[model samples]
Target: MDNGRAAMNLAVLLALIVSLLFAQQPKQVVVTGAVPDAAGGSLTITGENFGFVPFVTLNLVPLTIDAVGGNRIVAVAPIKSMPAGTYVLTVSYGPSPQETGSFQLVLGDANDSRSQSSSDVPAPSISGASTDAAARVADRVITVADVDREWQRRDPAGYLGLIRQLYDNRRRIVDVMVADELLAREAASRGLTTEALLKEEIPKRTITMPESAVVSLYQSLGDLTRGATLEQMKPALRAWLERISEPEVAKMNYVEELMKVSARAEVFLAPPRVQVDRTPQDATLGSDSAPVVLVAFGDLVSASYARFAQAFSKLTETFDGRVRLVFKNLPLVGPGSIAAAEAAQCANARGRFWQYHNAVVLPPGAVDAVRLKQAAADAGLDRAAFDACVERRQYQSVIKDAIDEAARYGIKSVPSFLVNGRLAPDPPPFLPPFDFLKRVVEEELSRQTRKP
Candidate 1:
């Protein structure tokens, strides 16, 4: 009886170990590649760990799932009306991480039946004063494309700024529309009017401003109060604060929570991007082989650039070896700006660009002959050689070229940036926050890793 009991105990121990090992297996979701259907309007994705039914999206737009299996998924591509371009495809399963891949989809005639690799789509004819032309200067037609090219060449910065503004406005409108629709649907489901639903929800989420907060805000206002005492301003201040913070803030937070928990929404509308060139003569930081190369066009004496310089240094430290910074001089402030840029370049020639940059370019003050010499001396440069180099205006042509390049690239403002040939989005006021820059670098690194 004792031997039988011992054998049963050993058998139970073995079974428990096997169950634990199976439970510890890692979950994986990988989208390897996709093949467009020969008949068009659909695609097959081959991958692993696709659950019974997986959600698929192309550029954040959902697709109808036709079929699904553990390693293959068939989905209808809604690219019949979309413009011809490459799009990102993603797949997600319950509790498994989403995987992304890219594929090219081309638009063609409805009757034309060809394989996915066939390129039989005919180009649009542009003979004899095209209707799409921006202007017809007495038979010399200027197409819309021609106008766009000219605009980008002459005022690249302004062109990009306009594009960004348009995108922002469109995005904001879309967000409001989506939120409204979501609220309407949710209210209807709960048998309540939209206004009534908001009335009920917003109040619960709103928090009243504390007395201490009001006092602190009053103290910070200082001269903005127009010599009014705290007691006199208290009611106005509290009312203003409550008006800005209560219903609106609460409603926004409630919508955000609903977006995360109930519905999954993703925005894939990308900003306009421009290709920026790099040269061998550029003053640079970090390794040449770094995954991200950030090119900054700036005026040396500009206060905005000086403010950004601090954030730039922090970015380098945070990203470490993953990012490289290439500085180009725009020198738009004045002659003193030009002189300072030249002096920095002179220091670059002596292998002291960063040291001179810290002393001269990163400081907020007037740039003059004395200040230039003082900065060179502070950077431990040979004063005589540096002075001669600056007197000759050695890098004036280099600075001129940089300014011309900036104009060509539409970089009219100080502290413009490009990461790996893609233009960074314009920031509010002076410069982008450090966290925003960090996200850009991390995204570039991830993209590089995803490349074939």
Candidate 2:
């Protein structure tokens, strides 16, 4: 009887080992490439292991697949599913349930505003002038493509801002270009050339710079005069001061003017927004230039987050890409909570924070050491390193600092938030959390719009 029992136990153990081995076999799937287009356009996804069917999402928003092939997916992303910004595009196939990666969608020429030049720029009226005069004076619609072409024709420095992300150089350049175009269109509408209108308007607004200030600026620049008379530097100094003071010109309502005139002109407009922290250490999603930022403080084990995880996502979607979110850790529960926080940070280090967050933290389930490891695996984290990170408590101080910061703010709740540095007030109990958050966001947006 003892021998029979031993054999049965050995057989059971062998079966378990085989099952584990089969489960560990890698999923045969790979997203080889993507032919991305404008935000609302179709994105062709080329990949393997899609099987006969697949599912897709852009930041958890379901996508409508127009056509599906063995290794291709032609899908129509919703109208605003991806505004001009970045997103995590996820695809699910038989071998891979939810394979995810990042992709940036930029608005294309279909939204081009470029059409015609100002008719007031010495153009011939239909009532008079020769054929050559009529052709020379014709309206010129400006496409962003045309703007780009003109940019290329102009100095490389003027165009560098468009392609380069180094500085907000693009904003500076685009502002000038858009304003110039808008001004031209406005001038034409008033039956005057842009140059003529600017000549009249600028002189009235130009400030008289103090002589002492101009001299100081010249000396600070190590005398670009290069042994030329101080008189020579005076003009340059005055010019510099004048240009700096012209920000008022750039701040005009160019977009409104363009819309009023129905002129085709593409301009990169800046969002009116504020931010307290712009660090990647605090998890951030969406464009850096987004107008509103929602900062939240919570422990990974907070049950409160579970109630509003979907709500938070909905709030983000409802706002389009205008609002960016930042998540900071504040461990308040226990050792399990602390460990989970550290594990989350580790996953964040591996760029899997969102996945781990959904699977482990916000999911409606109790967490333990075993559960934490399983969550890490489900989040597609590197298990051995994740285990090491959790054991070592690598992000312990990070979580502690965040918790201390939350305390300083007089926040004792697990799901506290600071919307653009203003503590979110207790929202009305009648509305859902998502609606409350949306109201908070809309209020902030309205406030920004009201600002000069």
Candidate 3:
């Protein structure tokens, strides 16, 4: 009887312990509101279960956190002059960095009288009233169409940029999936595993780099080698080179052969295109009526821009009369960037824009007043007139206007390209490869031909 009583007591204790453990577990975090300061320099986020302190990012860029409480967080934006648009605010916390929630943060000009306070702004409705309505705010019904219409009306370019980004992401994923399926089917047809088939085909397509070529690559490393001799780094260097080049190249070549030559895979997915207007102020190359107009936004001092410039030069040559290259200044980097852009404009007035542009960008150096003057000489410009134009800052307004236009198009980074009014879907800090640009130009040409 004592044992039976003791067992019942133990069971009761266990139940109590389990209930306590469940109760102690933290509630799932939820971001209820985000409010930008009047100056738009700081953002305050209100949420539940932020877990002491949480890491926050606005549009994937980490914010400099200012203050954190259990239910509130304040952080400074990365960009001081953030363009007015809808931004994604993401929060993550805990030891393993579990994402708490994502909140949509709509913003307007800070000085705009229409800007509302945190209390005035409507919270996103969590529950739907009916199938037709997206949300119910008290007695008022908000439909998806209504939300979209309002968003489009407020910022058409931002809305379109978001849509294009979404389409590009989806298209990229679909391409990968289709390629995977094609490979799987091909493997099955050969009565071989995909892995086995890749192993058989990849080696045939791989190129073995010669010893001399490897040495040349090592010499090109310069300071990147960190005082290490070529002989000391030879094996590792070869391995690194092979790792970056061989397998990927072999795989891509094989996939191209399968898709283009063997299976003749056709992707009918149409890419999203925006109407990018050209102006007389734009410095351009090639015929005005060319089917492919490639508008390039770049900073003169940017290394990425330089790389893209080289590719652009090659592309113009390859396509000849078919492609028109338009250059627009987006001077985002360094103190000298704006000056360089202005100087380029001065060069443009003297019919030396391309020559001066190539001299400044094609070389690896910081652009300054001295270099600008020297480039003017190299480009066969009237140095006295060029200097005068730059001194007066004749094109400052033009550069400012260009910057504003870039912001309107949601372009925040340099080396951005728009091919025939369609923004090239390449992520920042990297330019599209020459082959990719060629393919885009070819596709644009084909598209134009199909048009009645």
Each prediction's whole-model lDDT (CA): 0.71, 0.63, 0.75
TM-score of predicted structure 3: 0.61
CA RMSD of each candidate after superposition: 23.9, 27.7, 19.8
Top-lDDT candidate index? 3
Candidate number of the best TM-score:
3
- Pairs clashing within candidate 2: 113-264, 113-265, 114-142, 114-143, 115-141, 115-142, 116-140, 116-141, 117-140, 123-137
Candidates' TM-scores? 0.52, 0.39, 0.61
* TM-score (C-alpha, index-matched) for candidate 2: 0.39
Writing each residue's lDDT as its tens digit, candidate 3 over 1-452 gives 99999999999999999999998766666889998885657889998877665767665455678999768999886445777776767666632223356676877754665565577678875434434687799999888778877887899778878878777887888888877877887899999998998989888998875665455555445455556566544544444445544666678778878987667676666776767767656888887777899889999888767766877778988999999999999999866899989888888877888999999988877777787788889899887888889999999998889888887777888878888877786632111446657877887887776533
TM-score ranking, best first: 3, 1, 2
**What is candidate 3's local distance difference test score?**
0.75
Ten-residue stretch with the least lDDT total in model 2: 128-137
lDDT of 1 by residue, 38-131 (tens): 4677878997866676766554345778988668999997555665454556565542222222332334443444424455667554333424
Which candidate, 1 or 2, would have the higher lDDT against the true structure? 1
